[model samples]
Target: MMARPPLPLWLQDNLTLRLQDGLLSLPTSSNNSDDKNSSLTTTYNLISKRHVISSLVIPLLRHMRLKKEMSMRSKQNA
Candidate 1:
């Protein structure tokens, strides 16, 4: 039997981030800013952080939390 190749950590993380980011892409696309006077980017760090936090960090956190809870419950039941 051939062993399946494991995905690289960077690719796995990127895909997970992309999946989370895809959820928010449509809404942001409609109001995208390429204007000369766009203050959102100049005044704050909110834009990029929102994408990173929501797309990457939050999903990972939730996934870990759910896995931990499930394992805890399973141990209790056992």
Candidate 2:
């Protein structure tokens, strides 16, 4: 099969960078009235993401520590 010419490395990297940088950024309000609602939504979404990542990490760390302690105790008994 004939292969097509590859795009330049710089073009590929720029596309990926643009996608990564362009995510659900909080909306900005020029007036005071709309600011309250927009800000609350932004805060809620940010806090939820933080909570989710923390919940997953904490249990994994606890399990790892417990396993390490058990192995150490077993070695001492042997």
- Largest lDDT belongs to which candidate? 1
Instruction: Provide the lDDT at 39 for model 2.
Output: 75
What's the CA error at residue 54 for candidate 2, in Å?
3.7
* Candidate 1 deviant stretches above 4 angstroms: 1-12, 15-45
Best by TM-score: 1
Kindly list the per-residue Cα lDDT of model 2 for residues 1-78, writing each as its tens digit: 999877446545644554465422444545666455777766766775565446544655776799999999999999
Worst 10-residue stretch by lDDT in candidate 2? 21-30
RMSD of each: 9.2, 13.3
> How well does model 1 score by local distance difference test?
0.63
lDDT to native, each model: 0.63, 0.61
Model 1 per-residue lDDT tens digits across residues 16-58: 6666755334332225456654464443345555766776677
Error of 1 at 56 (Å): 0.6
